[model samples]
Target chain A: MEIKILGTGCPNCKTLENRVRRVVTQNNIDARIIKVEDIMDIMSYNIMATPGLVVNEKVMTKGRVPSEREIHELLTL
Target chain B: MFLNPTKNREKAGIRKYSALWTGILVAIILIVVFVRFDLFERLENGVNWFVFGLLNLPADSHLASALEFFLYDSIKILFLVFVIVFLMGIVNSYFPVDRVKNYLSRNKLYGFEYLMASLFGTVTPFCSCSSVPLFIGFVSGGIPLGVTFSFLITSPLVNEVAIGLFVGLFGLKTTLIYVISGVLLGTVSGIILQTLKLEKYLSPWVKDILSKAQHEQEVFQLEKQSFKERLPVIWQEAAKIIKGILPYVLIGIAIGGLMHGYIPQGFFEKYIGKDNPFAVPIAVILAVPMYSNASGILPVIQVLVSKGIPLGTAIAFMMGVVGLSFPEAMLLKKIMSWKLIAIFFGTVSLCIIISGYLFNFIL
Candidate 1:
């Protein structure tokens, strides 16, 4: 599984990134986590709001950081 | 070294000085008359038409009903904007900058703190202009630039006026979504800016201020006054801000009230209703350059929503108007270069448009 955290480099984006990392590690999932910090790259995803979560190339959540359990469910799906 | 000329020279110098002062006074009076009679009143009256005419519509006219819808739904929005600004002024005065700095600086790269600040900012309802001074204080006090941005972005976007308008017009569910979205955006944007190592992009002056945190000590050194002393200061600040804003408020209300009483029904429906694909973008573009307080724009938004305009599009438009007005951009020019201003506008505009689509898709 591949999870992408999209943001420029703000505190919330860092939080989301850390939370996702924790969730992935705890689940023992073989997932690749990537952070996109470039404005153009983030914008290319058509995400105006930052700290977005992209799971398997589809935007799953944005603007807010979802809970670890929520991420687990999203990954499972 | 010259001949004996003291007495006559003194009298002549005094007379020349008096003549010069009289000439300056006459010029000033003439200029005041010209401005008052020939320019100021005319401009004021002309601008008033834009504000009032939008509200007053002929009964049979196509726009009358649409205008009426807005007028009726904007009262809560007006109340919220006023309350938020007032409260923020109080809070700003109450909490000294040192305290905020100490709290933020205690932790290094704590994401949770940023989120909290963003949430607090959203609830406060300060406009971008009013928030700038606070932002300057925060960043200069050694708080992370990203954390400051979190507060700055959310303050205007999630203001009380927007919330009140949402609650009154769309009810609790929509209001909740709006609040949640605002917090998320603020937090995420803050974190992203942090990651990019963009703090270096800030002006050298800002860096200099932050480096010399010792200077801020003087700000806190003032004799700590009791709550009683503080209360008067708070009241004075509030009164000053209110006095400054009252005219805009009245102007906004007058237009909004008139719109409520007039406007034709279904007029806006045919043009930018929910089904229109271009409605979202068009609304975004139109709202970007416009300037108005929350109270001023609420009536217009209410009418659009009543005419079946999509909720997301209307929200995007409102955000554009309130969060990224032309006036704000112009004012920011004093603090930031034109390039930064353009980037700020572009980034926020894109954010709003995407948020609009996201809401439309989800809700």
Candidate 2:
């Protein structure tokens, strides 16, 4: 599985990235997590707010950080 | 499909809270009525009495007066901000950002689009740091650059928190003027920028994004939730906002209190007072580099007004600080060319200055 976190390195984006990292390690999910910091690429995802979570090229959430449990569910699924 | 699990339990929770929520709703209404009927005057008097009569501090002392100012303003302004944020939070849950974005992209409102955009700017709660993504989203979504500009301009300048602080500090009349002027400033600036046909000034990065296929439109499932189900989330959001801004509010009030007690009457009047023909422009210019949120700046503005600065100049400074900050410029720099940023800032600054002069002349 592939997960891309889209943001311009805002604090919220960092928080989301950290949460995603923790959820992945704790759940032992087999997924590659990538952070997209470039504004151009982030906009391609069509999210108006930062800290978007894209799993398998599909946007799971945008503009807010999801809980760890939510992230685990998103990845495991 | 999403993280919203335990649907049955959530529904049950909503049912259980309905009665308690009703009581909360009634209490809120009663408090609004109480605040409306000049109850703040009584509160102010109580503070004054506590400071002067109970504390036995001489009214003439600056320390006593400053303490009184700080305590009264902190309590009154915090309460006012909480009420405004809570009410706006409920409104926000109903009008989510995705819905607004979809609506803006899907419809053509003739000339009224700019007005609609400006109004959305006021209601949307995103901070200045989020402006870049929003700007990119709107432009790439095929919304006009001008309409996007309207949203970007007013989003920071006018908001519920700012309104609450304005009402707390400057009263309803000035707050109304500030809000009307802020919205108009955004609308007018957007219209003017749109006519300039400055699309080429956009960075190559954005132009590249514009050429790509637009992403699939997704409807937000969260928006379909009933108000009762959304109530707990709204309360949590409102509380979070209050907690976030509490420190700024206190520090601002503290600074304002010092000025209120220690600054001699007519001190600021000697320079930026109404008699100074250039005060408005100076205030606006001085405020551009210094960035602070509305909560931090409004208390200082209240003190400045008390120090004999004209209301228009003070308000102009407040708008400049909130709207045309260096940090916002730095963020926008990632997406826009220097020339574009200059034009955007220059136009907004000019509008603010003109409004300042108008405000001083009228008020």
Candidate 3:
């Protein structure tokens, strides 16, 4: 699975990235997590707020960090 | 189809409606008690007694007054912060950024759009570091540059945290003036910048995105949850915000306490007093490099006002500190040219100064 975390390196973005990583590791999910900090790259995702989560290139969430269970569910799904 | 998974928690039933009504009922009761019982005055008196009578501090001493000021202001300010943030959290969960962005993009309110944008900025909670992505998002999403500027300018200046502190520190009249002035600053600055046609000054990367952004924009699917389901998240967010700002509030109040008690009445008056014609502009100029959120600065502003600084000058300084700062400028540098950044800062600083002078004149 491919996951992209969209942000401009804000605190929320960092927390979201860490949460995603932990969920991936603990659940032993096969996924690559990429942090997209570039303005152009983040804008393309159409998210007005930081800490967006993109699962398999589909924008699953933007503007908030989901809980670990939510991340695990997204990963499993 | 993937979005539906997130909506699994949106339970539907009479229970949800009942929860909503219960919340409203509780809010009404709190407001009734807060208003009818004279809670604020009683609290002030209680603090006064605690400091003077209970602690056995001399009534005439500066230390007693300072201690009283700190305890009263901190409690009142912290309580106000929690209530305001919690309420805003619920409001935010319902009107999420996605919905707000969509609304702004799709609507054409003529000149009112700028005001609308500014209002959005006032309510939406995002860290200052998120400005770049938010700027890019609004711009790329076909929102006009002026409207985007309105949001960018007002987002930091007028927020719930600031509002709460302002109300606690300066009471209703001054707080109202501050809020109205903040919104006007954003709106007026936006209109002025919009007239300049600064589109060409955006970063080349933004230009590239603009060139290619005309395609059918994807509708970001978001889960719709009832307030009941959103309550837990909202509570957490409110708590998090209160925790984050608690330190700044206490420190600000502590400093304000010292200034309140010990600083002679004419101390600040001798320097930035109302008699000084240049005080407002000087305050604004001096505040440019100092970065602080409203929570940290408002308490200091209270003391400055008490010390005989014109209300206008101190408020201008507060706006300057809260609204325009080097770090925010650095963040904006990501999406704007040096020329654009300078213009943005220049315009905001000018507005803040004018506001300071106006405030001094009126008050």
Candidate 4:
């Protein structure tokens, strides 16, 4: 599994990354996580808002963080 | 495919929705009851008396009275912020204003187009920091220099938080002027800069990008998201805003409270008062370096207006901090050339100054 978090290091972005990390660790899932901070790099994903989440090359969410259960469910899949 | 997670807590989710509805119904009933029984007034009066008692100083103590006033004002303003921010969160959830690449990439736009773009910028929610990325996105996507400039200014300066706080703190008339003037400042500056043919001022990296057709295919997907898909996200965003801004609100209101209690009317009148026509211009200069978020600054603005400072002069100071902060300008340097940065600030500063003077004279 692969997850990419996109933002320019705002507070919300930081929180989202931390949450994703915690969820991944707790689940003990074999997943690769990447943080994308560059403006152009993130835009290439077609997200208009920060703190976007891309899972397996698919954009999952943008502008807001998903819930813990939501993350857990996504990982389980 | 990623979004449809089976409801693991279907029971819990149902209960939550029911609870939400019940809470709303209860709130409505409570409001009606409070209005009929004058419970709200009684509650407020009691709170005031309780604050006085808590201070435990003589009524004549200037500092004690000021503390009381600060407590009262802060509570009121905080409550207002909480309600407005929550509603705005829902609105934002429903009407997500995606920065349209197609519209922004236009080679040339009429004056009305610039006005519309600036106004759109005002209504969409964004902070100064987040706005930098949007600005970069617009510029990189071949958004006209002037139109992009307008979005850059309006995005940070005139958002829901600023406008809501203004209306709650300064009343409708002043807020109307501030909103209109803020958007107009963006529009006029955009037109002026475009006329000067300042596209050369943009960073070479941004200006050189002419990938019109290839980049067009990378459009934001999720336009067809169901309400269920977005509900949790909306709540999360609204909660983030309230939590993030609450601290600043308290701190701002505390300062405002102190200003109200301790500062004499004559003190303000003497310094940045109406007699000093330079007050507005001075405020514009002072506010840039002291830049903070609108949430942090609006309470202080409330203090200035309450302190007998002219509306226009105080507004100039507010615009200064909100519109063009030193930090934001520095950040813009990433994509904007030195000349472009200078032009952006120069035009905005001039417009802010003019607005300050206009408000002072008219009102």
Q: Best-fitting candidate, measured by DockQ?
A: 3
In candidate 3, how many Å is residue B159 off? 0.8
Candidate of highest TM-score: 3
lDDT per residue, candidate 1, B192-255, as tens digits? 6656555454456545655764323332332244434454544454455555555655565456
Q: Give each prediction's DockQ, rounded to 2 decimals.
A: 0.01, 0.63, 0.64, 0.36
Better of 1 and 3 by TM-score: 3
Candidate 1: which stretches are off by over 4 Å?
Answer: A1-77, B1-98, B123-133, B161-172, B210-265, B331-337
Deviation in Å, model 4, residue B231 alpha carbon: 5.0
Candidate 2 residue runs with Cα over 4 Å from true position = A22-32, A67-77, B1-32, B36-38, B211-222
**Candidate 4, position A68, lDDT:** 80
lDDT of 2 by residue, B29-103 (tens): 868887688778888899999999899999789999899999989998888887777777766665667767777
Q: What is the C-alpha RMSD of each candidate to the true structure, in Å?
A: 23.0, 5.1, 4.2, 6.1
lDDT of 4 at B96: 58
Report the lDDT tens digits of candidate 3 across residue range B55-89.
Answer: 99998999999999999999999998887787777
lDDT (Cα, 0-100) at B271 in candidate 1: 78
Report the error of model 4 at residue B337, Å: 1.2
Clashes of each: 21, 0, 0, 0
- Interface Cα RMSD for all candidates? 12.3, 1.1, 1.5, 2.2
- Candidate 3 fraction of reference contacts recovered: 0.84
Q: Give me the displacement of residue A48 in model 4, in angstroms.
A: 2.9
A best-first ranking of the candidates according to their TM-score comes to 3, 2, 4, 1
Expressed as tens digits, the lDDT of each residue in B1-363 for candidate 4 is: 554455644654565456446445654675577569975467567666776676567777777667776666666666555555555554555345563444545434555767877877775777555665676566556666777777777767787677768866887698899989989998988888778888676666656553342233354332444445655665576667767777888788788877888787756776677778678788899887776667877888788777787889888888888788777777678677888888779888999999999989899
lDDT by candidate, in order shown: 0.63, 0.84, 0.83, 0.73
Model 2 over residues A1-77: C-alpha lDDT tens digits? Answer: 99999988877789899999999888888889999998778877878887899999999988777778778888877
